[model samples]
Target chain A: MIYLELFLNFIYVGITSFGGGYAALPIIQHTVTKSNEWLTSTEFTDIVTISQMTPGPIGINAATFVGVKTAGVLGGICATLGFVFPACIIVTILAVIYAKYKKSDVMSGMLRGLRPASVGLITSAALSIITVAFFGQELLELTFASVDLIAIVIAVIAFILMKKVKFLSSPIAIIALSGVVGGAAYLIQGALV
Target chain B: MKEKRNYKILLPLFWETFKLSAFTIGGGYVIVPLMKKKFVEKLGWISEEEMLDFVSMAQSCPGAMAVNASLFVGYKMAGFIGQAVSLIATVLPCLILLTAISFVYVAFASNTVVKAVLTGMSAGVAAVMADVVIGMIGKFIKNKDVISVIIAAAAFVCVAIFKVNIIYILAVACILGFIINSRKKGAGK
Candidate 1:
């Protein structure tokens, strides 16, 4: 029954969480915490934090975290399977359709449209990430006081290196170096305090 | 036509996706640029333009961003099995890490050192994304289509300033492209 409920709830999340993982958090929170009571409000919030801490998509991370907590390892697999099922089916079908009709004028037009729109979408995402990183605030809520100069310096320097230096192109290198810098910042702050 | 399955290609695809799934932290948007680096830039499995097209299709659909992108990539490179392998590979890291953390979540969740590392990494993530935006927009600018440029600018404002739903903006932009391109008669992007 626990496995069934976990699969069903996450399947529901998969079917409806149309935009991306972040926008789906509230809906997931409602289903897991409010309706099933599988997790307390505090636990659900903690899962969100954990999602941030871990690698990969937040939606998959949350489903696995909840299912593993609720049932066990197999439960985690079940919940994850449920969550990814719809996307696989939907995207596969769409891909087939796209492949078939790709040469059509309408398809070509839509592709044209998507090009600029994706640029916009990615830009929006970039801005949001920049806001959270440099300012420690949401996109709409930035202020001069919330600014983190250390983070900004890291980002700018990384960007420059990524552009100029051949070896710095891989994101893994940048991410690892950023972590070390961040860890050092933490230690320095702790020592001063 | 059933695409012939090649274990040679399949193995590398699996390992690359698995490595990326494990290391790509931050969030959804970050993965695309990274994938561009891997698949388009390094592997030569896909072209630069083809990568963007797949990205648009992936982002347009509903699902985990990471999963959706992999689906397109797998489907292109290795067909249905590739899709399954990529999907499994993408989710495997999450399942493994989250389950492991579930046992000691209380400690893991409140660890300030982890927070600081992620904070610093977020800055790195931002720079990566900014580079992506600039790179993509640079390509768009090369086309020198005034209307397309306007569309890109307008879409940015709609999302960033007005806080509009991204789907709506995407819908309108797509339709505009359809109408305007078709009107030009024999024009194709």
Candidate 2:
């Protein structure tokens, strides 16, 4: 039953997740946290972090992670398969149809509509993650006093490194460096206490 | 003869996809330029125009853009079976790696240092997410598309503030887009 639920949930994600993997974050958050209560928001953010660190599309990594956490290996397989099932079928059909009508105005127009919307979804998703990463709560409840300065500083430094430093631009390097920084900070605090 | 030729290329196709999926660190977009080099320039399996078309189609379609692009290119080259091989090859590496990571992650979950590290990594993840948003908006600004900018802002509000379902937002945007585009066409005519 859990496997079945996971499959159904991811199938929905695969079908609706337009724009890209990042766009799927909101949908995943809706299903896993809001609807199913399978994971809390904090855990959901953790999965996003893991998905980025791992090699693959964020959507697939998330499906696998959530599936494994929910059920087991079988669940992971089912969820992964479910997530990509729609894409496989739909893209095959689209390939044929688009090939035939490569210059169709209707198709181009639809894409134009979709493009900005996808950006919007991605922006919202980014905001959601920022809220969780810094405030540890919903954005609406955010107050000046509730902000986690340590997280804010780490995020700013990571962004600067990725944007400015050529050698550390890769996401994996930034993540590893942040982990080291966090671990070192904790060790220092522990020593002092 | 064509059928036999496709069968011969299947293993190579799978291997190429597997290698690409395994090595690429970033998400779907990162693989595109590299895929072009291998599939178009080196392998000569697909033409440059065809590869660009595949990338665009992959972006427009659902699922991961990277997987979609691979499947589309495979289907173009060798048909259904080729699509299957490419899809499996593209996903298999990540599937295996994530499974392994999941097992180790459980064990590390309780470690204090690991927890602290994960906490710190979360911040980095946030910054990356912001960069993605900025990159998208920057693209719009460069294009100087006011409508797209408006739609992007509206969509942001709809989701972040109103908490509207994404499906509805997309639906509205599509309709609005179609209407505006058709009107522009009419004006041009």
Candidate 3:
């Protein structure tokens, strides 16, 4: 029954959640933690971390991991399916419809509204994660010394460079360079601490 | 003669687009590098310059980067039908993966080590997301569209300060976009 419930939970999340993995986080947290009682806050937090490391999106990973926990391999499969099936089904239909109406005014109007909303949603999700992960209680107590300030600064600089320079669309370069800088900073911080 | 010649050329492009879409792991900017390697380097379906242009268009357009990319690549390959084929090919993998995975999720999801790794990776996940947004902002600045900049700022405020539901923000942005674009079109006439 728990396993079945978990499957349904993932299906509910997958179908309703419109944006990407990050956007679905709060919803997942609410369902897994608040409503279902399937996972403790700590457990859910760990699930989120593990989901991030896996190959697929967080929502998919969460469903897989959580489903497996409750029922075994079958459960993992169910949850993952429940999560991704919704998006897949929806996107496929949308793709067909969008293709058919590629030139129509209604399509254009809806997209025009959708694009900015996506940007805003993406931005808000980023901010929420930043607030929780970096700027929240523990970091505040440390007075930002142990904070990943270098990462933040590097990110801002990268944004500026990308904005000002037309030649920097190879985001791979920026991600790699930032990773190196961030990794080095963490090592230095660890040694100092 | 033209029909036979076009089919000869178009069929392979459909297969190629399918393969590209199948293996792309993460959505949005995560697949940018992979697409560059495949489309720009391996297949020579498009140039690096063209890929960058596609990225810009994909970002600005409404919908997933993956879908937008398919449209661009498919259109470039064989016009309209290519777009349909690519979109299907790109989307099919997710459907298959989801269908297969749904049956097995409940079992493997409960382990201790798995939980720990997932927790550790959350920080990394956040880092990656931050990286993408920052990179986009840098690119966006070049466009110098005051309206876009303002929209971004207002969106940040609406989300961060007001803590409004995302759907509401999306609705407002859509309405605003329609009005603004319509006004611009009217003025052009």
Task: Give me the candidate number with maximum lDDT.
Answer: 1
lDDT, candidate 3, residue B10?
64
Give the range where candidate 2 chain B is weakest over 10 consecutive residues by summed lDDT.
Answer: B24-33
Error of 2 at A98 (Å): 4.0
Local distance difference test, candidate 3: 0.57
Candidate 3 residue-wise lDDT, B23-133, digit = tens: 343334445554654577557878754564454344433334555666677666665576656666654544445434435434445544443333332333345456556
CA lDDT, candidate 3, residue A130: 53
Give one digit per residue, the lDDT tens place, for model 1 in B66-96: 8888888888788888888899889988898
DockQ of each two-chain model: 0.74, 0.40, 0.19
- Minimal lDDT window, size 10, model 3 chain B: B115-124
**Which candidate would rank higher by TM-score, 2 or 3?**
2
Docking class of 1: medium
TM-score of chain B of 1: 0.90
Question: What TM-score does chain A reach in every model?
Answer: 0.94, 0.59, 0.66
Candidate with the greatest TM-score versus the true structure: 1
User: What lDDT score goes with residue A106 in model 3?
Assistant: 59
Best-to-worst TM-score order = 1, 2, 3
In terms of lDDT, the poorest run of 10 residues in model 2 chain A is: A167-176
